[model samples]
Target chain A: MIRSLAELKAQAKELGPRRCVVAAAADPVTLQALSSAQKEGIAKGVLCGPADKISQAASKAGVSLDGFEIKDCPDEEAAIVAVEEVRASGDFLLKGHLPTSSFLGAVLDKEKGLRTGRVLSHIAILEPASLGRLLLVSDGGMNIAPDLVTKLDIINNAIEVAHSLGIEKPKVALLAAVEAVNPKMAETLAWAQITQMAARKQIAGALVDGPLALDLAVSEEAVKIKGVKSDVAGKADVLIVHDIAVGNIFAKGLIYLGGAKACGIVAGAARPVVMLSRADDAETKLNSIALGAVASVV
Target chain B: MIRSLAELKAQAKELGPRRCVVAAAADPVTLQALSSAQKEGIAKGVLCGPADKISQAASKAGVSLDGFEIKDCPDEEAAIVAVEEVRASGDFLLKGHLPTSSFLGAVLDKEKGLRTGRVLSHIAILEPASLGRLLLVSDGGMNIAPDLVTKLDIINNAIEVAHSLGIEKPKVALLAAVEAVNPKMAETLAWAQITQMAARKQIAGALVDGPLALDLAVSEEAVKIKGVKSDVAGKADVLIVHDIAVGNIFAKGLIYLGGAKACGIVAGAARPVVMLSRADDAETKLNSIALGAVASVV
Candidate 1:
């Protein structure tokens, strides 16, 4: 299994280079990361944007785009061309130097977009310096406030990503404020329902448990102290939150306060979609590229 | 200002000893923490429970109870007696070895309880090892899912605690998944409303801003990167979450993964309530007692 981000990059390198198509590829940071991934033999670059703007970005980033294929186009039509390129022969997609709405608009276009009849969700893969392993948290960026059915799709997407990382049967934990089902807290009720559904084989290929607090989901000592009996209580492979705020805040808390290294990708799409934020560091962007390359193979 | 948990404990010691009454005080860890606090001149212990059980607990904890005042009572009436004692002369209340429902039942009693016509919320004070400062998170333990009105109460309670810690005007951040007001995300709408209310003087004594992601709330680099312009974008003293799940997960993620030292107390009560969980370590229990003693004075 890929236990760390370093191992993930190594695995991606071993899988050979995959084609990464970047829409509106005029951001210096995106060019730098893609250049690094190409140099490391993890991805082949396909840049789609205005030629002058792409040249200016590559010069600003101090990267040489010698072997990369460039598709010159207008700024408004960059996303369309990039999506079409990925549909034809490219392996995955990346968002760069464009509004998220416009980038997603092209990807979600009815007749020409990459659609799999599934809800789109964001998954964050983190390797906290103190935890000694990789952890997956989902729906932190894509879904705002997901309902029960959307949460099920988010869990399924996370499980698929985990399988691609060589975890055959991931233990999924539905996070809540407390372990018990409180009627006043609506998320707990949904988690309980999902747990039952997973037990009955409605959600297959994972051992799913619900309504666990953050401590019980990760710490064996907390599980023993609380006397919680569950297969995923202390050794959760994936954490699924009810809404975007919880997952977003929780993952960022680990990164900012806990010194965790993290990378994120959007799942439940036709191909892996790497969405890098401006605040993400260089390491996180490169790790995300490697993660997308690995998940694209699956 | 109290920049760290160590400073918080020192300030509590300088404020002299406050009378702390623990309901059903037959837990070894609680006795140990109370004994340490008493030795440090942070608290004067008033143990309210069965005499034999308290004695056995003290012995198990290897602590001396010579200076403590023992209120011998039956197991069923311990919470009632403890509440009445705190109402009569004690400074604050603590939950020792009883069910939380019963303990809260006594505190929320109509006739002889610690009620101030305000809603109760939980506030956690954390000092992440890397941050070099203390952060306050609210409504993580007491309120499950709070509406806008309850959030107002929670923010006011946090501001009061901050004032006691020497911050005259605390910067409060209403945490959400993102900074923008996305109509699909219900919490952003509520945060925008709260921000306007704070500006209108409906919520006083704090510079309140909203809809900030975790990174934007704490990291100046993130604020500069995103070009976010807000008074509380990067230096938030108090973070108010919309629900218990977000706050709970965020706080625990800091403690377990970030190597942070944390302590929590329930606010919006007549007196601060220290409610330690079984999963808490000895240092956390002691820190909580010191926190309760400090907040009780306000």
Candidate 2:
């Protein structure tokens, strides 16, 4: 229902300030984004990084975080502490100066991390004029070449995140090169299996269809033109990518070249994780925060 | 330099009518698009399908083809005949009614098919306003789960097509989940090798860099923000996808949900093959033909 990013922000503001637990937030851009988000009343900052670097970054970015909480810790320790903190009291977790390995390691920690017996995957929300909806693309960051079962978890994770964004009964398209299953094209084969599983009440909460090409899944006209019949065609709310490399490039292609606005989050955790890139605009970072906040509430 | 789809078509017209040989030319949209191209002096069509069916399709689309050539052939033999005809006289090929399997069968035929010793691939033109450039995504339609060597061919093929589009030295972004190369990530490994190859002039005609995420590849601001330094970070002309399934879905996600206008063509062939789907608009189909026209000449 949000017509524009501005409206999405307004909706974000109404949800109240989000509690973000930042891990090793020592980078200037990371701090700057967090500072901006805080100023916009989108999120309340919980900085967990090397205290000296964090404060220096804040000062360099001309941000006075007198009201912000700075939890001093080394990068590795910050990752662990941040996740633990978020799991205990915060609404969401964010990565900062820590290495991605350590940052993720902390979150995937069996005892203290936020695991929900589900696959942790990255989903990007992109708004392109071509589709006229907030499209979600998944597993671009976390999962590599996922097997059939991992794909099911990825889809379920994306659907839960979509529901959090208030899209009830999301149309899920398992993308492949063709509409029919081919043994050589593993993606189509996987799509066929997933569709069957969804039909058999295996993957729940989303309408699943696949072995669909990119054009067919999002363009109803393409569907009609191809004489392809599917409930999810041209109306897909979620596009489950075949692999991380493809998803990563495909999602980025849209945002960078396709005039799309995007925000990202790692889903299927006990609590949602904000993984908005430093490259994302303030609006995108804020939207991601809003997305994470919404998902957290859900 | 062309801004919109209209400009792309005008540019196509400036270059003169293209010579196209369409296999299984019984689809109405294909006929209509070709008819428009003919009317606008964008392309010269050689219809290769069942003669009656081609005529019927032309009539169905309300197009009068008084000066066109129609090659009568059954769907089973249409692909081979179309490939052979195009190789002999036509400039490019188009998919019409035949299945992709059959169409590709003729294209990959050992002796008669249009094989140039390079793997055939699909490169989609994505025009997203934020970047203000025609972004090319490849291997989304033809190659499935390409290995390192095949990835090289895909990049080479995409680079060739990019050069034909007047992007003399296109920036090729080898995308992955993150910018850094990780041993666990196969895409990053491939990207690292590809970047080195491009640097050493093994892969010519493009500025290639990667192990980059979506944002870093296209958003220069993101490059600075993330401090991820690379020449291709924010100005990638071509994004070489890992496989067809990912490329297909990723491109579609942009067109359908990100508000982008896309034109798809099979590149890295003897001649670029424009396969406009029945779902694409007149402009998309025409633009693809224009792209093919330019690519064919190169």
Candidate 3:
């Protein structure tokens, strides 16, 4: 139901301020976005990086970080220590100037990571022109070639995100090449299994079905015409893709070619994480921040 | 280059009159579309069905088929005979008032069917709002888990159709989840092989590259920023998909969600074949007939 960034901001305000910890927060764009979020009362930031670099970025970006906490960490290791600090202090995590591998390593660090024994996934919430509601596309940025069990985790992570968005019993579509189970297509096989699990009440609080094409999943008319019987077809809130590559392209297509508005996050962690791309516009970044803040509370 | 159906009609005029054989052509929509085409001198139809039924439908649709050829045949054998007649005399084939199974059975029959050894593939030519030129999406309606060879066939089929549309040396993007040649993703591996084949000149008359996500393939800015190099990156004319379901959904997404105009055909066969969907508009069906007529000549 969230239409624009302004609406998301209004929603976020009602949820109060969320505390966020930035790992290796030395990048100008990163600092700018975080500072903007903080100034807008969307989130309160705890910047973790080299103290001097963080201030320089803040100054260069023309963002005043007065009264905001800045935790000085020499490098990535310090970022990890700061991550631990913020996690214990009830603040969400964000990546900054650090390499993606290093940042993720710290988050997945067996002993000190934010893992709750669930497979981590990324979900992109897209507002396309052809639809009246938001669409949740999952695992496009994470979990490549996940097994059936891992897919369960991915679906659950996306469902949790949908639940946070106030969609009770979110409809989930397991995407495949065809709507029928085929021995050759592993995605279809997995989709069938997943649909069965949801039907048998193994996976609770979601109406699940597949293997649906993109059209059948989103268009109720297409569903009726195609004679696809399921609770999720034509009104899918979540589209659980077969692989990272499919999800990645599917979500990106909605944005670049389909003229859609999108915001993304790394889900299945203990806390909601904002993971906006650097090339994303100000609105997208802010929308994602708002989503992270609201989702964290939910 | 066609922004709408009106533009497509203008283009169809220059392509000359296409010979179309409509099987079981007793449907009012089909007759109306055919009459419109005839009035514009874009197509000449050979209607095959019960003669009385065809005349009644034509009259009801406010069409006079005085100049059109009506080949009398029973309802049960009309589809097969029409396909055979077209295969022998006409340039293209159109579907009307027949089950898909029956029509496809005749087209795929080894002895009398139109078979060229290559796997029959469906190509949806879309004109997206974000794109200046047409986008050819393939295997959405046919082919399931195409192995490396079948994928090559699909690519070849799409390339052939694009070539018939006057696109010499089309830029083909073999789509996947990512741009890298990841061994874990089977689609990427196939794309890498296909790319190599194109590089070695095994796949001729096209510039092929892959494992590109939809964004990188269509957005030159994304390709430049990501440092992904390929001739087909930003100007892909043909999109060789991984599977039928994905291709189908992708094409439909462009149409329903992105407001794209497209003409579909089953390519790599003995002759150009039109297979317009029931969901398609009159213009879409007419454009497909035009495409079939043009492809048949090549």
- Considering DockQ, which of the candidate structures 1 and 2 is the better prediction for this target? 1
| lDDT (tens digit, per residue) of candidate 1 on A1-298 | 9989999999999999999999999989999999999999999999999989999999999999898999999999999999999999999999999999999999999899998888889999988776777899998888888888899999999999999999889989999989999899888999999999988899988999989998999999999999999999989889999999999999999898788899999998899999988788989999999999999996
Ranking 1 against 3 by DockQ, winner: 1
* Fnat values, candidates in order: 0.89, 0.89, 0.55
Error of 2 at B157 (Å): 2.8
State the DockQ, from 0 to 1, for candidate 3: 0.57
TM-score of each: 0.97, 0.86, 0.93
Return the lDDT, model 1, position A289.
Answer: 96
Candidate 1 regions with alpha-carbon error over 4 angstroms:
none
Residue B231 displacement (Å), model 1:
1.8
lDDT by residue (tens digit), candidate 2, A97-199: 7678788888888988888898888898877754457888888878887987788889999989888777889999887778889999877878898899889
When 1 and 3 are scored with TM-score, the better candidate is 1
Model 3 misplaced stretches (Cα beyond 4 Å): A1-5, A182-184, A227-229, B1-7, B52-64
Segments of candidate 2 deviating more than 4 angstroms:
A1-12, A25-42, A46-58, A66-84, A130-132, A227-229, B1-8, B22-27, B48-54, B70-88, B99-111, B226-231
DockQ of each: 0.84, 0.60, 0.57
Candidate 3 residue lDDT tens string, A209-296 = 9898887888888887788788888898898887776777667776888788889888877877777676688888888888888778
Extract clashing residue pairs from model 3: A177-B245, A245-B177, B140-B248
